[model samples]
Target chain A: MPNEAVQYLLTSQRDDGGWGPYPTLPSRTESTALAALALRLAADVEVGARASATSGARWLTETQLDSGAWALGDGVPGPNWSTTLATLALTHFEGEDGAAAAGGAWVLGARGQGPNLWSRALGLFLRPSDTVELDPDLKGWPWVQGTASWVEPTSYALLSLKRLRLVGPAADTRAHIDEAERMLLDRQCDDGGWNYGNSRVFGDVLTSYPDTTSLALLALADRRGEPAVTAALEALPGLAADNDSTLAMGLVAVALATLGGDPEPIRARLRNQLSTWDGGDIRGLAWAAIGLLDGSDPLGLLDG
Target chain B: MVSRRRFLQAGAGAVAATSMACRGRPDPWTPEAAKKPANSPVAILGAPDYDETRLVEVVRQGLGICGISARNLRVVLKPNLVEFDPQGVINTHPTLVAAAIEAFRLEGAREVVVAEGSGHRRDSQYLLTASGLQEQLDDMGAHYVDLNHDRVRRTVLKSSFTDLGELYLPETVLDADLFVSMPKLKTHHWAGATLSMKNLFGIVPGAVYGWPKNPLHWAGIDGSIIDINAALSGRRFNIIDGIVGMEGNGPIQGVAKQVGVLVFGEDPVAVDATGARLMSIDPWKLRYLEATDAFLGNVGEDRIEARGESLSSFRANFDVVTAFEETKVEPSTGGAGGPARIDK
Candidate 1:
């Protein structure tokens, strides 16, 4: 990571020890998690980086709900998708196992709502065009409890589960991971990448987005040999290049590096892009750090 | 005999009221008050295309006709910037947004900010760049707020159309003195038509509610629209972009349909009703507008005073999906006879 970008993330921590998407915004779980992860990645060489990560981790633990989930913050709903992000950040710290495990448990129990019997009947008899071609009963993570599953949240949840070492030896956690993996595979667009959720909507095939596609690829890194994963890997560079977004490009670099693809070209493009980048988007900056900096996979997705 | 559409709509309303009662929250307005709403003026002005100079004058004229007050008020313009479509059918055109900002400034507004919590895209920077809104805002020296990441305040719903009792809305929306909803006049596969009222869904923070605001969809799209609009009842205005709209499957993935008119009104229900009418749709048949008619604004034609260009002059047929065929008002059958479908 560039010294200036590292310094910016370090100095921008709020009094509550969290980071917002940008300065002047209230701190949020997702933003703070991204910042903390970036700082943890920088800890090896940058001074004060470890301390900042610890403080951000402390805020995350402090704000965790009694039900073992983290919300976006005040006024936002609880036990939502950010719990995965918070849990992932907590895994980096020592003595934070209890909080992180509790989060993992909550995530394990959380399930996205699918078609009920009544709705299934309606779809079969009346509303055929409204239904997408996916297993209605296949459960995955949702942005909120009782809502439909989406690609980004499900991918993040899988990444969090993997980081917590919950997936192994064909246990219950492994079963859940397998189900979510299937869900992600089912949601992949015909273009070989994933959309926000549905691959096809109302008979029209939805196109893939670089950001969601990258996250999905990162979550499914272990299955890189699978046809879907291979196809998406082949499509990532072009999509990222076309998007011209720091967030998308950075995520693409991270996914490629983690999946053992040739990330050097995308990283080179990302370097040029970040040099002239002037936006104050913290996620974009944090992603640039995670992708550009020398590091083992920060979230431990590659760890056994 | 009541049609199947009316029966379903009535059933939905009853369920909402029953749920509200079960939750111990009395509705602020009675159904009788909803039925006898005072007449509101909706102005429809003709504009051929997105010529910035011509749109500025037309917007000013429409604002005047709708009786907008902008002196020293902090205005927030929430235009539909949902996704990028090369045909330019998916979002409200940037020229219209720039025109609205200029017209508001000419009307003596203190400040105008363009805000939208994009329902589909998480990356606001990408959406802005892809839609050309960033360039427009930069050129006009306007501020833009990504409401998804903005500070929020929990607000209790004034009306209970959904079981979601309250929503954490962005402070930028709630604090604005004049909150203007600039929606692309288009057909939604689920909602029949997404107008100024339906556009209010963007104000609900995705940071809180998540992308696409699925809770709103799950609670029911029509009811959520009523709930959000009711929450912000008094401090709202509408400017429907019908100059070049969308038809068939929309809110996204639809073809462009040009109507050559802009619809404006203080009452969102009336403005949306006029917008629906311009697309040859029956507003009375739409569930949200029907419920909104009971209290929020006038969807009834007799209760809306037409201003500027006549409604019939700019009437254009908008093709809808197979499901929404009933939503269209047939040229020969132009009365209160169209059927409405409830999206589950």
Candidate 2:
């Protein structure tokens, strides 16, 4: 099944050496990064994985913005959210250390400064809700600069930084990573899983999503024994148990495996799910492959 | 009360006159022609209920008035699938999406694809299932495209509202012969209201823009709306799902405010302006509408020819959040510097 998934990903790669969310879409950095990471992790289990991963790494290095970050692609402005994934993919391969370091530095510097005093003060009176319990002062990585921090992007940043070992070695870097972790913890809903950003808004408790919850937990993988982590893990089943989302299922499998929990069920489910996938969804195939690869840290590849 | 026959006759005359005015131009429906009172006829039908059969008829009639003949055209219906809440009407009703698909098919559409890139959540499958849109799409045998993950083309903007000069629009959006803005009329906390123009935010894929498409928000919501509206100038139409709307704080996180009416028009600005009026919001007060008034078509009530139901007959004051209500600008006086902000 992993071999088939890898073949799907390899075949799905465009002539540009990048993959898109779907086979029909143009090659995007996000899908390409995910595909590269999956192919790298599955090299031992499948043939041609190494070759595909090399081409993907080349695409990442070529597309890196002068600012040391990757844009969303096709001139969509930014050194934005896709940067972390691109950085991680580049760092996994040989001879790309220079590009990887620059990308890593950009990710570390991308932490958004929490909204200004005026914005915060105005928020107090704007649609005041009893259901939401988030602190306005906690800062994390935003999808873009000068916007409220969201869980998924923040988690990706954390995962990438941790993989690069940039979480320490400098006072400011450590502080930034610490604050981001705090922000993630602070935004957890009463229901135990995380939403996109706001836990509650205007007295309505926002529903927790499986993909977000899985990503948040994956970022906090080292702290699986913490009370919050335990609570989130317990709450995850309710959110994700019956979920047919390939993205969510893949993330959950990786997160559970990292936390020393049984990922077999999720791995099996994802494997079965991918069998029916008509080879168009590159993201799903990439995630499914990464999730099913046993005892492999796709994010931690080449870190040590 | 304008009769349907009279409205169609007037529309035909305007089309002919515009065709003569721009003889060599590729598109006869120029901005000047679209703004003419005879051209921009908005259909405001009294749905009074969410009955699928009745709503389908309303969509058929409204699309007809707007001159949306679907023969051989690949139509894309962009519904407000921003978030899903079974208990709350956060998304466009699945019944409405189904009705539109059926109506288009009956009108001889080559293909009618239902697409949305939900801003609030990346899990589109969950949203599709939770909102019951999946079931409807399945029953109708319609294809659903997650616009956020679709192939993209870098499009240069002719008019930029924010610092961004270019945007990566989904290939699906660019491939369509006709793009229908099927938005749920609601009060937006940041932008005053999420109608036709605001709903276009979903067309920007999350694969590029991030969930909630934060880049656009950072670029300034009003400016991005104006920019996207300008980019999608021609081949754009608006059919607002006003039958059940969210008010007070919306796009997500608002209580349902049932307006029980379906609003439709060829001119997105005029349709949205009329929608704002139905919600008791002054269209001139919205920053985006005010800024793009010249080229985007008229938001003024005087420029739009109302058909079917009257505005006053279905008027409901949707509760605007304090933040948006505070940002309201005074009506434009045809002066320099655009509409001025009245000191509250």
Candidate 3:
């Protein structure tokens, strides 16, 4: 019954695994995507964990509203947050795509532009079953845990494709990365953090915030060996009051350590600060719990 | 036994420095909860006796000098700005909000900003903008922050609800010396009626966990509400707006009937006790009553010192919005046209 937290999160699944109400739960998208991501983390922890994760993905697959579109509650099933997040959760499951055809049916049936979170996410996941084809600009989309309004949604769609290494032409990837990196580089807080500015879904309420900084840290850690990442790593210590905020910062700590960036002391410091969020809170708790468990001792997930 | 032993061992630092995050305590209503008998007095706050003007006065006077003053305090009025629209009684009304601002101002208040991290979809910003909150604040010369868009400071402070203090509140509210929550007396699906004590949860910054607004049902009401109530230590003040109380199912989708009464007090529990009594409900019986119910706040009918009019004076029968009844009421939408209004 106390799994009520997980239940509430799962109840949020769309016909796709992705989520949004935009900025938070009930607005919908972030919860679904993060839950999907959380499910992925739990699944990766144990083999059947992925099966537990798939229930949500299946919900997305089953709930693929008739008209071949998806939404949070009931609206025109446009290819926005819900459609895209659902696509990500369903396709990225740990198992083979036994339900791929059914999922693909819903994806192909989708209306609206073919470049939204749904369309872009689909292009990355379900393809010709050959090469990972992607639109050039899609590579540099902001990979935020939550949507970042126009820049973030587009940026996330673009980056999700890049993470899959599915970019079509390398030139487009460069352009996308350059654009996203420029946007990211300029917006870095003095403490090497980032937050929602005018481009935030929650209004202008997120300055001096750690959540966005964590996303940016994830992005930088993905490029851990880079100079920009070095600067971001340098800024993390100044921002730390404790460990929950350290997921993004911790990832960078490991990335920096791996890069031989004077990280031993910093890694230990952030590691001590971080706690196991394996319990419940937000979608990031799903990912961070896995990361923390893996960090303590490699259970062999994505971080390893 | 091993898990409990392990839990005790691992919980060393939990008691030390924790934040204002919801602890994952087993909800009392969970199937697992029946194992332990839920024994506790349900706190009740009956409606006050005073008229509208006096209701405000009595609450301020009741506040007295609880070791705080208006001139020195950076007073922040956090009304239930959950979502922008006032039409739905789920949020604090602009009238009550303005009155609190005015009252705080009378107490020689320095600043009063009515803020919230409303969970409404933001693509509907044009719609939210029409909530008339901005205009009200603009006219009143007060700051209106979409906590969704406000600056926040994250810390892991100590809390009774959870061991790790969970995630502390954002500095926007945490920084203020005093936080006065003016919540509407409405029926809550999870918490029954979201009175004074329950409304303070809005002050928790959503950014630390990544969501802009707290997902009410995420932990149902226990983790969210209990942790919120437990985090506040200072003598908090709550003024319940029951002139038109929401009944049945509420906080959002309830019908507002004229229950013309204002309830207020220093202790959120005491004030809410008055509110529940006014609604003809026993505070102990309400669903989301756990967090504050345990506080020494519950005042039984015999013991409760009532100053204003009693619940007997007004027996107005009002049908509140008990559940989600879909109306044609689309918020001020963008490309989406507004749902046809019934009044027109």
Candidate 4:
């Protein structure tokens, strides 16, 4: 990891011992978790770096709700989308086992059972066109409960579960992971990328976005032999080449490296991109650090 | 059983008798009748096309009708910069935003800032650059604040439609003297249609609500719209871009339909209603508009006065997807409130 990126992540930490998406924004769980994981992955035992990660992990553990989910903030809703990232960050610390386990259980229980019968009925009647095929019944994760499942939240949850080995030798855990995998595959766009969630809405095919595609690919790295995964891999290079988004570029690089594809070109491109970055964006800096780790399993608790 | 001439004669006689009886007495319903006058006026100007120069004049004329005076007002033009699509009319046109800034500046407004918290993407810089709004703002020397990362203050909702009793809105939204909502007139798969009122969804900070502002979605799209608009109350005005609007399934991912007009009004509900009329959808059918009629603005045609171009001249049948067609509410019978629909 570049020293400058690491330093940026450390300095951008809010006085509350959390990090926000950008320097000026209030600290958020997702940004704080990603930043903490990046620092832990750097594996520099220096006092300043270790303290930063510990403080961030502590914040995540403390802010966790009684239900083990972390709502977005004090007044937002349930920490539905943020729990996975927070759980992954907590696994980096030694005393956070209980919080991590509770969060993991909460995340496991949060899978959306798709829309109910009434909603499905409404959908069938209200859908603009039937040209695009999708099964709303496929159980997957939603960013929030009672809403339709989307790709990014599902992918991040899967990545956390897999990294923590929370999907243990139990049958239900295995089944849950298998269902989530199916859901991710089902949501993949025909053009080999993923959108927010649905492959199509109405008659129009929603365009696949680079950030969502990269996150989905990163979560499904072990299943690259699957046809959908292979197609996604084929589709990623062009997106990475064309995308100027720092976060997208970094995530794509990490995903590509994890999939045993060449990372050198992406790494070089990212380095060039980071050269122009001022590091005020803590989220981008965190992703850039993780990408620069070059195949290191930052979120994997057992890797070390 | 009566002849037509005899029926007309009887009706006239009854009216004359009632008028004679009420002549020296004040009618009990007079106060209520006086209170509920005609609906607010919404300006629908014909621009023919997206001529930047012509758009400036059209916007100026529309604002004039809407009673917007720029002198010494801190104006914030909140445009919908949801996402960028080079071939699609997804975001508000940069030319229109630029024109609004120029119009406000020419009116001697103290300040005009272009603001939006993009619900779909977190990277405001990228969205601004890709949407062409950044260059427009830069060229016009107008400030552009990403509401997603802007400093926010939590405001208690005393009469919220949603379960959420409070919202953390950006300081810019709360501080602006004149908050102008500039939404691209488009059809939405979920909300039926997204006009000025639906566009206010972008005002909620993404940092608090999460990208795509899922919390608002969970709170119920229609209800959330009511809640946010109610919070902003009297400070809001609307300017809708109907020059090249989206149809079918939209908000994103839809075909562009050019309607060649700009709709503006101080009442967001009325302006959106006018835009909906031009799109050939009944405003009374939209639940958010229906629910917010009394508090926000009335959607009733009898209440609204039209300015500039006539509605019939620019009306086009916007193709609503079958899914959102379920959102269409039947016209309501006159009651205490305006139109009402059971929540879906």
- Residues B33-136, candidate 4, lDDT per residue (tens digit)? 12223578888888777677888888889889878787999999999888888964998999999999988888889999998998886666566767778788
Per-residue lDDT for B42-92 in model 3, tens only?
222233432435544544553442323577567877777654345546566
Off by over 4 Å in 3: A1-304, B1-69, B84-88, B121-128, B154-164, B210-216, B287-291, B315-344
Which segments of model 1 are wrong by more than 4 Å? A1-4, A75-77, A116-130, A166-171, A276-279, A295-298, B1-37, B331-344
What are the runs in model 2 whose C-alpha is more than 4 Å off?
A: A1-4, A65-67, A74-80, A116-137, A145-148, A166-172, A296-298, A301-304, B1-39, B48-50, B154-161, B290-295, B324-344
Most lDDT-accurate candidate = 1
Native-referenced Cα lDDT, model 3? 0.45
Can you tell me the CAPRI class of model 3? incorrect
- Candidate with better lDDT, 2 vs 3: 2
Residue-level error in angstroms, candidate 1, position A118: 8.9
Candidate 2 vs candidate 3: which has greater TM-score?
2
lDDT of 1 by residue, B1-344 (tens): 12212423454445545445557665444343243348989998999899999999999998898888899989999999999887788899998999999999999999999999989887888899888998999999999998988898888887666667888888899999999999999998778899998898898888778888888877767778887888874467889999999998887998899889999988888889888888888887677777676677887778889899888888888899876787788644333333333432
Q: Model 4, range A1-304, lDDT digits (tens) per residue?
A: 3545676787799998888767766777878888888887776643477888888887787788999898665345556478888877776677777787788788888887555433443353234356345666666677766566678888888877776674332124567778888888887888898887777765567767767887888788777778898888788877667666667777777777776667678778878877767544577678777777744444453342
> Model 4: which docking level applies?
incorrect
Candidate 1 docking quality: incorrect, acceptable, medium or high: medium
Error of 2 at A294 (Å): 2.2
TM-scores, all candidates, are: 0.93, 0.84, 0.45, 0.83
Root mean square deviation (Cα) for candidate 1: 3.5
Candidate 2 residue-wise lDDT, A30-53, digit = tens: 889999988988877889999889
Best by DockQ: 1
Q: Counting only residues 3 or more apart in sequence or on different chains, how many pairs clash (N, Cα, C under 3 Å) in candidate 1?
A: 1
Regarding TM-score, does 1 or 2 come out ahead?
Answer: 1
